[model samples]
Target: MNQKLNIAICSYRSATFGGGQGIFVFELSKALNHLGHHVDVISGPPYPKLENNIQLIKSPGLDLFSTFNFKERLKIFLGKKNKSSDDWYEFISALFGGFPELKTFGNRAKTLLDESSYDIVIDNQSLSYGMINIQKNLPLIEIIHHPITKDYQYDIQFSKGVIQKISKWRWFSFLKMQKKVSQNLKVISTPSHNSKNDIAKDFGVLEKNISVIPNGIDHASFTPILDIRRVPAQIITTASADVPLKGLDFTLYAVARLKEDFPQLKLVIIGASRPGGHTERLIKRLQIDQNILYRSNLTRHEIAVEYAKSNVAIVSSLYEGFGFPAGEAMSCAIPLIATDVASIPEITQSYAELIPAKNSNAIELAIRKIFASPETYQLRAEAGRTHIIQNFDWQKIAKLYEDLIYKTIDEFQC
Candidate 1:
């Protein structure tokens, strides 16, 4: 048996419900722990929900985003008289439209981690300068889920106004630091070949230095719950509103147009929308507001229940390092339709129906096809569950990670 390693996984802010990054940290730590390694997830707020066996080290920093009101945020800046200089730096940077979490997280986490010795450290996408300093003491591996260059380009291309465009430019300036820090790292891990290629090109890293490891699915939590009766002509998708990368705008158009064919058709979104945001306005404009339902802050079991009740699933993402929703939906034996973009196709094209990106007609047409041939699509859906089980089992992925950790350690020693 190989010697078990003590690993610390770093994530700046891990919202357990909102995004994939938090779930990635939570699930990866759990999987690694199942293989006998000790895992400590070092994260800032909104913290990840981890199992009892795994340790959660609260990452110390000024978590500006969590303070919902501006008054409380102002207190964070004014209240701490003895605060470190980095606190002011973090707040001021964020005030100027820059994302300072990762940079600040590295500064705070390095000192916290140095108190304890670990054989290896796994950074979940915060390739900040402080990580470079921490790597001097321990072997480090970066899991760049995908390059942020895609997000940056998308934001610039889809800016709503001149002021918004300028704000976005400042917000993503951290990409420069990420690019600089990534180039010198000896080993890196990414979810797919598409992401690996993008990282290499954008960050100027060598292809050989990066490993392509697929994200795993928990079969137990996401299996098909056939006991639940499926709803008629209902569709499900996971997307955030007003985010061009998520392509929620196109999804709304599809759902609105879809109502003409199936007047009783329903659509459930597994994400939150700001009450007065662009999505709300779009819903009103389309006059199909009654046809849509929004569900957020759901547990894994609850999400599976929603999947079991739905007739089909659509993924309208313009880009994804790994399309978790598609995999989770397929695991639950619901037929999937995802855009043919980036790593979505890399993992899902085998089992899912691929459609051209940003096309509402494609989404509407695919939904029609699935409903048209229920018997054939049902067979495909069941087959999808098997495919997810065989290809993306957690244990198999854990073993790969275990091997990678050992390899990183060996190379570090040499």
Candidate 2:
């Protein structure tokens, strides 16, 4: 057996409710721990829900996004002691719409980590300036799930006016720090080749500096529950947030188009849609309000059961660093219809009914075809399930990371 190593996974703001980063940290830590290694997840607010064996070092931040009430947030911000003076920067940056969590959390994590020892550290998409210093002491690998430039492009394209475009740019201004910090790092990793390529091009990092390590699917938890009767015309899809990036708007449009033909349809979304947001308004406008159900903060087993209950699943993402929902749905033995964009095709390995992105008509047609041919869909579902179980074992992924860790440490010592 290889020597057991200590690891720290840094996530500035883990998605405790409905996002991918938290799940990545939880699964990675659990898998590494299972490999006879000690793993600690160092995070800011909204931390991940890891298993009991894993340690969570809570490095709390201002959590500026916790509320919209200005006065309440102001009090919290004012009360924070100016230890490193990044608190002021966090306050001002967030005041003008810029996100400072990455920079602030990195400062806190650096101090906390300096008081301890770790063989290596993995920054989970928080490409903050502080990480460069952390790597100076301990071998560090930064994970940029994908370049934020893609999001910026979408923002510029979707903005309604000059003011909106400027506001969007301000919110994402942190990308400057990300790009600068990423360039100084010796190693970087991403979940898919699509992301690897984008990170190289956008962050100006050489392609040689990036490693592609696909995320592991916990197929053991997301197994087929044969006892649960599949509900007819019951559809399952995941849109973790109401952002345009997830392409929920297209999915909603497809559901609206399918409503007339499939009146019995019930689209169960695995995440929440913002109240009074575009999604809610669109649901009302399309008059398909009655057909949608939202289920969030579900455990892995719970999500699996939901997948098993569904007759079909959909992944209508415009882009994904990795399509976790697509793989998870397949793991549950559910037939999937996903957009062939970014890493969706690569991640699913063409085990899905692939369609072009941003086309509601294609999504509608794909769903119709799946329902039209049950025997064929069933075969595809089983094949997808088999592929996920064989390919995305977390244990195998941990071993890959272990090899990378060994090589990095060897280079650091030399």
Candidate 3:
């Protein structure tokens, strides 16, 4: 093994079961440490709670509007009292997009890079110009999980009306910054080939400069178990809270149609329902509100158990750069039916049954077809399992990252 290299990973949020960024940072650092590298995770609010061995450098955000428990801290700083979490969220939500703390994070990252000699600075989607302009001459490697442009496009198109659609177009501002910063980075890696192509097209970077490294899941933790919570005829999916791009409407419509044929059909959503949002309204209109189970704050093992218990797993995203839910479901050996969009087909090539992304009828038909035959479910699940184990084992993928780090270090030295 090569001598250990100190790796600095900067992410906007911690993977505290809230979203993918924290998960990516934590898992990547764990894998790097497992490979005998020193990994320092620097993050803003909603930080990852990693093991004791790994070093965590907190880059506290101004978070003017505290999202969760930061209201007290905000009060202490400003000499105020009795501010609620929602008030902080509303305040922060207004300014977080253009907040200067994010820029400060870049300065802090630069300081860490300068003082702590690292072989490489691995940025996990913190595409600020400060990171781009860091003084450290060390190789800077950026990991764009997927292009934000893809998310913006899907979200805009999913809007119910023209006004809402135009409103979403403003979120594309991140793309401009992402493009400018991405072009200067020497080695850029993404989660999937679909993402690689997206980066090439959207950011105007050459395909060769962008490498493909799929995200990994813990094989031991996500393994199949004897599931006791089996609802005889139920389907499960993980959706982003109030995000139209997730295709929750499509899944709800599909389940509504399937429920007529299979009345016992239930759509168990592994995400919290936003108050008075489209997801909640759709469930009400479909008259299947009673059949839906929406919950948040699930552990990895808990999610795996849900996968094991479900008759089938569905991913109804309008587009996925790389579908984490689909991969995790497959890791648990559940038959998958994901939207035939962006990278879903790439990961689930012949391993899954895919349907047109925005077609509710297609999703419904796929569900009916799978449940109609028990053997089909078994075959698809087995194939998905084989595919994931062969392609996405974290232990194997971690080595690629190790080799890439060494190669980047050598090139930087030369």
Candidate 4:
């Protein structure tokens, strides 16, 4: 048996239900600890909930996202007993419509790393200058799930107008820092080959230096519930509704079309929509408001139950690095329909019903076909479950990570 290593995982922010990155930090830390390693997660605001054994060292930031009102923020800035440079930078940048969380969080994380000792540092896509600074002090392995450049491209492509395009560009300006930091890292790990290719192209990193380690499904939490009754015509998808890249608008259009034939159809979104936001407006414009339901802040068990109850699950993203929703739905034995975008095909393989992205007609047709032949689709769904259990178990993924960590350490020493 290899000696257990002292590992530190750093993230700008982590929340159990926040998004993929947070879930990645939480799950990976737990998995590493389960493998007999001592894992410490260093994170900023929206701290991740970890298991008892795993230690969490809170590296607090301005937590500007938590302060919803401008008045509250103003009060903090005006009354200065004493404040860190990071606090002021975060408040100012965000007030001016720039994302400074990664930069500020990285500075704080670097300070923490300087005072702490770890055999290796695993950065969860902070992709900031501080990551580069930390590399000079300790061997660092970055987990770049996918390039933020793709996200910028998608946002720019889908912007509503010229003003929106400029805003999106300004907000994603951190991509410049990320690209520079990514290029200097000694080792980079990605969740899929598609991500590896995207990172190489978008960040200008050599493909040879990027390693592929697919994310795992928590089978224990995401498994099929035999006793739960499936809701007829219930469709489920997980995405941040306001983000255009998520392709929820296309899914909404498809559901509106499907209601003409299947009036009972219900689309359940496992995410929140801002009041008067684009998604909310689209829902009203399509007049499918009554048929759609948004459920946010769900526990893992609740998410699994949503998957088990649904007739079919959808991954409508224009692109995904790993497509966790698709994997989780498959783990719950639900038939999946996903767009053939980025890494969706890689994750779903032939198990899911593949459709062209940004095409509501294709999505509608896929849903109709699945409904027409329930028996056949159910078998395919079962095959997907088997696939996830065999290939995407977290234990298997952790072992892969363990080997990667050891290899990275050995190479750094030499």
| Model 1 vs. true fold: TM | 0.97
Give the lowest summed-lDDT range of ten residues in model 3: 93-102
Alpha-carbon runs more than 4 Å astray in model 4: 76-81
Model 3 per-residue lDDT tens digits across residues 250-312: 888888878887888878899888788888887899899878998688988888888778888
The per-prediction tally of clashing pairs is: 0, 0, 5, 0
lDDT-best of 1 and 3: 1
Report the error of model 3 at residue 272, Å.
1.3
User: What overall lDDT, based on C-alpha atoms, would model 4 receive against the true structure?
Assistant: 0.89
**Cα lDDT tens digits for candidate 4, 181-213:** 899998999999999999999899998889999
Q: Kindly give the stretch of ten consecutive residues in candidate 4 with the minimal lDDT sum.
A: 73-82
Order the candidate numbers by lDDT, best to worst: 4, 1, 2, 3
Tens-place lDDT per residue, model 2, 1-414, is 279998999999887656888888988999999999989999998878898988899986888788767897798887777545777888788888889999999888899888778999989988998898898898998888899888888878877799989999999998999999999998888889999988888889999889988899989899999899989899999986557777888888988989898998999999977888778998999999999999987888999989988988999888888878999999998999999999988878768899998899998998899889978988988998899888889999988888888888888788
Pairs clashing within candidate 3: 14-22, 14-47, 14-48, 15-22, 15-23
- Per-candidate TM equals 0.97, 0.97, 0.90, 0.97
